[model samples]
Target: MLDLWFSEFHAPDAKLSILVKEQLYSEQTPFQKIDFFDSETFGKFFTLDGLIMITEKDEFIYHEMISNVPMAVNPDIKKVLIIGGGDGGTAREVCRFKTVEQVDMVEIDERVVRLCQKYFPQTACALDNDPRINLIFGDGLKFVQDAPEGAYDLILVDSTDPLGPGEGLFTTEFYRNCYRALNDKGILINQHESPYYKEYAYEMRRAHKKLASVFSIATVYQFYMPTYSSGHWLFGFASKGLDPVKDADFKRWSEFGLQNRYYNPGVHLGAFALPNYVQEELQKED
Candidate 1:
């Protein structure tokens, strides 16, 4: 939760003004505000740390980068699963790749999906029309656990922060379930916490370790967002055997020509190059 703080100060010129703002994370208080955009479900979008995190804007960035990078790497990806993308932006992006034969979107909240479709049309417009896509309103954790082994080629966990309803998703059990739900060469992608901010690094590290236990290769990638606490954020990529850096065949990425604002063949290749500190931290068994 974001905390709000207020105080009054006096200057040498004898002028006094009241200061008010929000505190992001645990330490960073008095966050400044820019433009507040409209949201059908959440009321308004609050800008902080140079990231644009409106219900609509997050749909574009999160869905675009999450779905496209893996799809670009695995060009022949046929079966896909999206967990917790109630807005449906990830589903919309998954449909763009013609190689994808089927996509199953599992969202815990039926109301969020319905509200976004009704009010945030731009974010959820493509959900209802796509014949290749199936929207299933259910708990992502249970759904993945009960799913048959080697079912999905690509699985994306597009969930909220681990505070309320999303707590179970950040656990080690969830990662284990995801590993079991994937095919032999199946790939799993999840939204990790911010690298620039240390608030959730401990939890993220645990999640990373759990994924590493099951997958041959596990790596973290970063992207810049304007409305989040920090400008940069991380995502986890895990595969049974696919080496994200070396296994990515560049020829396929050139063929797709998926126009993206943030992700490209070069960006996809570079994102896996974690800094020295991050690499060491992720490897540690905290």
Candidate 2:
């Protein structure tokens, strides 16, 4: 008998490991290394370039928090553009909204989408069924840059940490393009790095500052993702005229009657109340 583990570093000083049942698959795509494993506790999970992307157990938290918060603030959102999120969890959550007429998902690697659809149907199920969705296999940065001005009502950047292919998605120029692609009332939600560790915290602050410079209102929200680095992750929320806290139409969102495991009207408001330390960190001069 042998013990097998799939592990990832939360920080240089810390790491998280899961008991592995089997190595389901492994591949090196042109963009990055990809692996899928079956874990005793977390169920089936996958990683990109050795970083955890999604797991069967807690995928709802990341997907729900990213999609629901913006939709709750503006129930009439029709066109949405998702950059990254090849796993399709983000798309699944966004498709739940009947008001959304179009969803354009851009992923750098088409292999991720194909693999997830084959191995993790739960997340990839809606990738094809939704007629509103237009799946684009290309670079996200270029999609936004080429997009017509005011082409979308919402843009959800479900990107990975700033590294490798995801690095360009975090740049100030990328944020600027996102602003131009969005309508006046459009909202932008991005995967803000965690604030728990020094390395991740630096990226968090940098991303907040970049978004703040591009959008009229910019803020960050927290959620618990057990598999991600610290079990504490964040999403950046930016908009031209909408304040996620002050302008969120809770009553209107509730009318949609969408059932969710982690997100609700109450949680939507509470997620924006950042801790004092996090606020202080984001306010630091560059």
lDDT of 2 by residue, 182-219 (tens): 99999999999988888999999999999999998999
lDDT of 1 by residue, 193-282 (tens): 765445556666877877787778888887765444454567899998887777787788668777777677788877787778777767
What global local distance difference test value does model 1 have? 0.70
The lDDT for every candidate, in the order shown, is 0.70, 0.93
Q: What are the runs in model 1 whose C-alpha is more than 4 Å off?
A: 1-58
The stretch of ten residues in a row with the least summed lDDT in candidate 2 is 1-10
Collision count for each candidate, in order = 6, 0
- Candidate 1 similarity to native, TM-score: 0.80
